[model samples]
Target: MAKFFGNLNAVLVGGLAVLIVIMFGLHSAVLGESIYPNQLFRYLHVLCGIMWIGLLYYLNFVQVPTMPSMPDELKPAISGHIAPRVLFWFRWAAAFTVLTGLIVAHLSGYLVEALTFQPGVVLIGIGMWMALIMAFNVWFIIWPAQKKILGIVEASADEKAAAAPRALIASRTNTLLSIPMLYCMVTQNALGV
Candidate 1:
């Protein structure tokens, strides 16, 4: 339904449904061996990370850059409506991505190896740590500050003003860290993790 798709919960439910389908496909006969839950966890982590980072790029690369030029009336649609919705997805995706990533690493017998940055695990470990830090920033620093700045929840005028720069800095920091993190993720695998 139009109204259903328009809502955040609906969109999330849709993603979850897709995840379930992927798990089913992984188990289907034609796929050969059944994939472990840890393998599935890795897929979940990648999926959520994509959602979170993709939106972050959109906000920084497109929306924020364009906001000042837009009319005040148009601004509300973005700041008050669209941004809040996107951020809900952003923050939760960050949390779940981190959660699922850790679970996968542990289940796959890579956690300690990765954390210690053992020879074969170092690159991905770096990526994992970077992701953990980014997730922390998303949940603790950016989202809370954004709630005030975006007027999604009431805040004092002073608080609102303060929140904007704080949120921007945290988001930007995440962007910076993401580059190295992703490189390490790819390199680890490419190097035969």
Candidate 2:
């Protein structure tokens, strides 16, 4: 038990197993019957979106602002050790969030309507577009710039300097877009749009 709890992979699997058990108990023999494929996609979309936005917030609200204040020597610890792993999860989460969201929309029979913003799907469409833009920033703008800024790719001092602000701005743009994106997503479902 101690060994299982100590490992992150094990802990995650154990937690999920517990959740399945609880769900099974609650639903009894009808456990899988009430769960729809779209619901699964929705669950996955929300999970990935949380990871994506949570990391975006951590980068914007915590890491970026705090970096300038850290002593020069200590800065390397975050840049070298923490940022890389966080970025891996961040970018993948963004990708998966978009993928799962699209799957949900398609499964629910609104992919075209949502993308086209057909009268009833305008709000969800807006949220989807924002998410797409945010995902694009994560992959194309932020990740590329971050590679140089973090020295993952060889770069001159001037290049690294240039990359930092690009990454910062793109990240900040996503943060700004996230607010309206979240509102649209939540309200569309809540208000029955």
Among these predictions, the greatest lDDT belongs to: 2
Candidate 1 lDDT, 30-83, residue by residue in tens: 444445666667778889889988988988899878998999889988987899
Write down the TM-score of every candidate: 0.83, 0.93
List candidate 1 stretches off by more than 4 Å. 1-26, 29-35
Candidate 2 C-alpha lDDT tens digits along 101-148: 999999888899999989888899999999999999999999999999
Q: What is candidate 1's local distance difference test score?
A: 0.85
Backbone atom clashes (below 3 Å) for every candidate:
0, 0
Q: Model 1 RMSD to the real structure?
A: 3.5
Query: Superposing all C-alpha atoms, what RMSD in Å does each candidate have to the true structure?
Result: 3.5, 1.8
